[model samples]
Target: MANPKRKWSKARTARARSNWKLSVPGLVECPQCHTKKMPHKVCKTCGYYNGKVVVQSEEQD
Candidate 1:
């Protein structure tokens, strides 16, 4: 096994870590249900995707 030869500098490490952020995920409204959901994914509330129902029984849960 090998180890790092030099300790990482604070500035460099901070700059690299600066890009680590919690950006809000992209969301699009379902045309049928008018609910916010992730783009191109089945809506958890209504289970619709691409203008069609993908799940048969979802509201029971």
Candidate 2:
């Protein structure tokens, strides 16, 4: 088996790790409820998508 010829430098390791970052989830506003939600997904608050009710949502008490 082959091994690394030399240890990775701190700067090089940091540069490589800099690209490994957490990205914020993409969000869109629900047309019916005006709440933030993931794109192309139903709105939890109103159970709607693309101006249509995909799921029946329970009314808030």
Candidate 3:
């Protein structure tokens, strides 16, 4: 088996893992319902996508 020759430095390890933080998903408003939703996906509240109805929503008014 292969092994590292030297110990890794703290700065090097931190720099490599600096971008490991989680980022919030980008959300957009549903045009039909005007509610927050992920882009290109069906809105859970309105069951809509691209200004059209894709799924039959359960909580309809």
TM-score of each: 0.64, 0.64, 0.65
Cα RMSD, each candidate: 5.5, 4.2, 4.2
Candidate 2: RMSD over Cα atoms?
4.2
lDDT of each: 0.82, 0.83, 0.83
Report lDDT (Cα) of residue 16, candidate 2.
Answer: 89
Ten residues in sequence with the least summed lDDT for candidate 2: 52-61
> In candidate 1, where is summed lDDT lowest over 10 consecutive residues?
52-61
TM-score, prediction 3: 0.65
Q: Which has the greatest lDDT? A: 2
Give the runs in model 3 whose Cα sits over 4 Å from its true position.
1-8
| Weakest ten-residue segment in model 3 by summed lDDT | 52-61
| Winner by TM-score between candidate 2 and candidate 1 | 2
For 1-61, candidate 2 gives per-residue lDDT tens digits of 9998769988999898987866887898888878899997888889887777788856743
What is the Å distance of residue 47 in model 1 from its true position? 1.1
